[model samples]
Target: MTVHEDVGAFSPDSEWPQDATEWLMLLREEPDDAEIRARFEVWRSASPDHPRDWEEITHTMGVLRRVTPVVEVPVGRQVRRRSVIQRIGLGRGRVGLAAFSLAASVVLLAFLGPDIALRLRADSVTGRQEVRTIVLVDGSQIVLAPQSAIASRFENGRREVRLLKGEALFTVRHDAAHPFTVFARGLTVTDVGTVFDVDAQDAGRVTVAVREGQVSLGGIVSEHSPILLGAGEELSARDGTTETRTVASTEVGTWAQGKLVVHDWSVSAVVARLSPYAPGPIMVYGKTLAAECVTGIYTLTDPQGALRTLADGQNARVVHATPWLTILHR
Candidate 1:
């Protein structure tokens, strides 16, 4: 099943070789074909462009196979080969060879279409303290925050995403067979089609917040207690205990826009939130100091300033345990 054989599948009058599918089938069943191997060399030498297109077809097939399970060959609506020997219709008089060449080109293009689409659709990485907004081919929007990395692959079975680090906000487009899933650390967040936020913390914690739809969060998250959260709801996991809490966080996604608003929270909790953005370590001197409650809006633009403000306003002192470490005490 070579590109020459499948001319009709891609374009009815295209002279493209239908050999791509055959090579794919052969590679899957019996990859070490001596004849195919020999033919590959000769084919490459035939024309510099021929080998390039051949590689493109093969690459396209591989991507398609990984993303979609079913591979089909169409018989009736076929692509016809064009005049291969014809140089921009120069060899039109030598019709047969030109037609064969044209057909090969069309079939090759068809096979390569899927691969090109995949490349255009995939989203890769977001570095430290940075943000990336991706518009997927399916029209979904994904905003990945700093230090986050995400990879997406869409196949017949599902649309999968692996989050290597940090956080992401997914505004998914609806596709049941291609359900969107974000994998991070030991957790997996699966969504049909919704807007949600996923955070992968360094301390073996994963948090999922649903802004406009529903999501099933599992793994180191809730574990056996897989929870579904809707708009304005969030779930957090730590040590093995999972907690689901509701907040009046109408602006739950302010961090994506460079603002982090913390409501009534303990000093320890506030310190924990500030740690990631802080230039140095932040520690509360004693258990009582750490447990002290903090209520204010801290600007993330200048985290060190916020620390100084905390010390001055709370009648607390900032102690330098070490150059890289600092603790707060009364």
Candidate 2:
């Protein structure tokens, strides 16, 4: 049941918690309203608890927004377009104090989760469809994929980057004295004067694809001996086991060129990669469709179009639940 439904009674609309919820929901519903925004600022600064209540609600909603529910499209198929906030049923205009307090306690914990720690330490971060390139002090270039983040540590004559989330393509400047290294999900890829892509995906799966030169790969790093992958090589690690494959050098980092290249990868994997470009979550449902493996190149120029094409190929359909969320159903 929704928090709104659980609260059998509500206080007057004057409470700070209720007012804060109403203001935030209204602003989100009509973000272009200047008058509403101006009034909101006044309300926020009215009292210390006003902004305090606002911040608490904002952080709760922030984490809730990312809690994508990839469940089966609701039965009866009465699909409707709604943002995550609306779907979760946070009281829109009349949230009771008790109701909001209940929801906030649960979601606030998630707001302070590991993602917050990553955000604190990250040197670079990219939002949806926002790819960024960072140049280190040593002249190496790091191209961050959409929804990606990284933290670089260059102290003690050691050049290393911790891939905090998503993926990044690194073009290292040759420095024999200090070898460049990338760490993601317990896997390590030490550069051998090369360009390589490290994709850190869900379930502790890390894929490292070398394009230009060579890289030494180690799984869980501390236990396994490091292996080498020269040009046109890729390695995927799952459960501490590694698989080496041959991928076209030109296919690496193709998302920067408006294309995504994969070989014998699952449809779910494709959705995961394309999701960074999509503003909201792109859910893939149905066992058969989710398990379907695909090959060949796909377009990233239009993530929605690419999703539709991928769903079509896998005998699934893309449903536009809202501007923020897309569902692929079989």
Top candidate on lDDT is 2
TM-score of 1: 0.52
The 10-residue segment with the lowest total lDDT in model 2: 72-81
What would the TM-score be for candidate 2 when compared with the true structure?
A: 0.64
Clashing pairs in 2: none
Query: Alpha-carbon error at 46 in model 2, in Å?
Result: 59
lDDT of 1 by residue, 135-190 (tens): 87777888876545677777666677877667778889888867788887767788
With candidate 2 superimposed using the best TM-score fit, by how many Å does residue 287's alpha carbon deviate from the native? Answer: 1.3
Candidate that scores best on TM-score: 2
Q: After superposing candidate 1, which stretches have Cα over 4 Å from the reference?
A: 1-128, 219-226, 278-287, 317-330
- Position 111, candidate 2: lDDT: 31
What is the alpha-carbon lDDT for the whole of candidate 1? 0.58
Tell me the tens digit of each residue's lDDT in model 2 across 114-226: 36677898988777778888999999999888778898999899999999988889999988889888989988888889998998857678889888999988758446678
Off by over 4 Å in 2: 1-114, 219-225
